[model samples]
Target: MRILLAEDDVSQAESIKAWLEMDGYSVDWVERGDHAILAIEQHQYDCLLLDRGLPKATGDDILTHLRKHQHNTPVIFITAQDSIQDRVGGLDLGANDYLVKPFSLDELSARVRAQLRTQHKGTSQILMFGSVSLDPQAKVVKLNSEIVNLTAKEYQILYKLMQHPERVVTREQLEESLYAWGDEIESNAVEVYIYQIRKKIGSTMIKTIRGLGYRMNLDQT
Candidate 1:
């Protein structure tokens, strides 16, 4: 799953980012609430790990913006506030979960997975379409009981495409999801990755929409 982590403490943010990546999640880390808001505005994330006392803007304010704009991405407020009223306030601002400071990495990771399940409408962690089964948590893909080897980009492209199954995923969306904010992106990078994924998963698994982009072949799976 893709996540946006909004925490001002550099060490804490890096530590969380490292573990989330190790746990098979693609994470984008930002220290300021403004950056977090910009990231959310420009891209989509499975969840947000937000620190309430953020500089430039507060986490609650950011969550309020998300709610006001109808961005339903799940949010987990990580703050030092541990009171019931504080928790209620966070929840009222649309946070799906709340974590007190000095919490365990294990607990945070577990919460992230839980939020991901919610994002998928509580679907099983094992994503499926026909004979293909994808375990996003383990970064594993199985095609008819056979393991499919894919590069990082290939897996990301396929994962992004699979998230919406039959719906078309535009080239811009694929590109934004695949890379971070400042990476030098190639003009044909999305197409190249799509081609590579098709070669591995089978040409018929993805359909190109003349000007639109690609979608998973839902008819077969």
Candidate 2:
């Protein structure tokens, strides 16, 4: 999944990004709330980790704009504002959760997972396609009830395809999910990952639509 973090603290942002990336999530960060707004407009992020105190625009302003436009992306306020009133106010502004700074990265991860679960609704986040299953929180993929070893990028690509089994996932969309700003992506990087994924999963599961992109074959088993 993709997450956008809006924070001005360089050290904290770097640490959070590293931790989330290790947990198999693609994270893009912006130090300014204006940039955060731009990124939100351009990308379909699964969640937003926002700091209320931001340059150019406040996190509250961004959240209000998001809600006003009816964008339902989950938002978690990760700010130093620890007062009950502050937390209440943030939640009132449409944030799904609130986290105080100097908090545990582990707890932060748990909170993110909570928001994701709520977004999925009905208490289950498992994604299934035919005999293949993926646990986003656990970062595990299984084929035929057996574990499948896959690189993070491969899992992300497969997850994207599985998320929309009947729709074509374009190469650009997959690249956006797998990479962040300033990351160097090779010309044939997507193709290479797709090839590797097919070998690990099955050859007939992913169908390449010429002149377009790829789609998951729901009928494949």
Candidate 3:
């Protein structure tokens, strides 16, 4: 999952970034609320972790602006204020969850998982297409009753495909999901991965749309 973290404290931001990255989340850090707004406008994020106190703009201000602009992306406010009024105010401003500072990393991780689960309407962790199942949290894929070992790129490609089964997924969409910022992508990189997936699973699983792209034939048995 992708996350945008807006925290001004350098050390605290770095620590949270490292922990989240270790948990297999792609995170972009911005030190100011304005930058956070810009980042949200630019990229699609599963969630946003915004500090209540920010430079130039406060987190509540950002939340109000986002809601005004119809951006319903789930947001969790991280603040040093532990007062009941502060927490209630943040939630009323459209924040999905509030975390007070001096919090445990375990609790933070749990909150993140809870928010994602609720935001996706309980569709964030596990994805099922026909008999194929993918556990995003565990980064595990299973076909029928057997566990299938997949490389990083392979898992990402498969996850993207399974996320929207029975629909055509163009090559460009797959490319964006696989490569990061400035990573080089070969012309047939996605095709090579598709071939690998078919070899591991079954050629009948992923159906090509001729000149279009590919789709998982989930209805087939």
Measured by lDDT, the strongest candidate is: 2
Against the hidden reference, what TM-scores do the models get?
0.77, 0.90, 0.79
lDDT of each: 0.85, 0.90, 0.84
Stretches of candidate 3 exceeding 4 Å from the true structure:
122-130, 135-140, 150-153, 170-172, 175-196, 207-214, 217-221
Give RMSD to native, each candidate: 3.4, 2.1, 3.3
The 10-residue segment of model 2 with minimum total lDDT is 117-126
Query: Would you give me the overall lDDT of model 3?
Result: 0.84
Q: Kindly list the per-residue Cα lDDT of model 1 for residues 48-145, writing each as its tens digit.
A: 99999999989998999999999999999999999999999899878999999999999999898888766665464777877777887667898888
Clashes in candidate 1: how many?
Answer: 0
lDDT per residue (tens digit) for residues 1-221 in model 2: 88999999999999999999888788999999999999999998989999999999999999998999899999999999899999999999899999998999999999998888778775447888887898876778999999999998998899888876899989998999988887799999999999999998888889998889999986784
User: How far off is residue 201 in model 1, in Å?
Assistant: 2.9
Q: Measured by TM-score, how close is model 1 to the native structure? A: 0.77
CA shift of 115, model 1, Å: 0.5
Clashing pairs in 1: none
**For model 3, how does the per-residue alpha-carbon lDDT over 94-181 read when each residue is reduced to its tens digit?**
9999999978888888899887777766566688877788887666899896899888778878888888887899998887655534
> Model 3 misses residue 55 by how many Å?
1.5
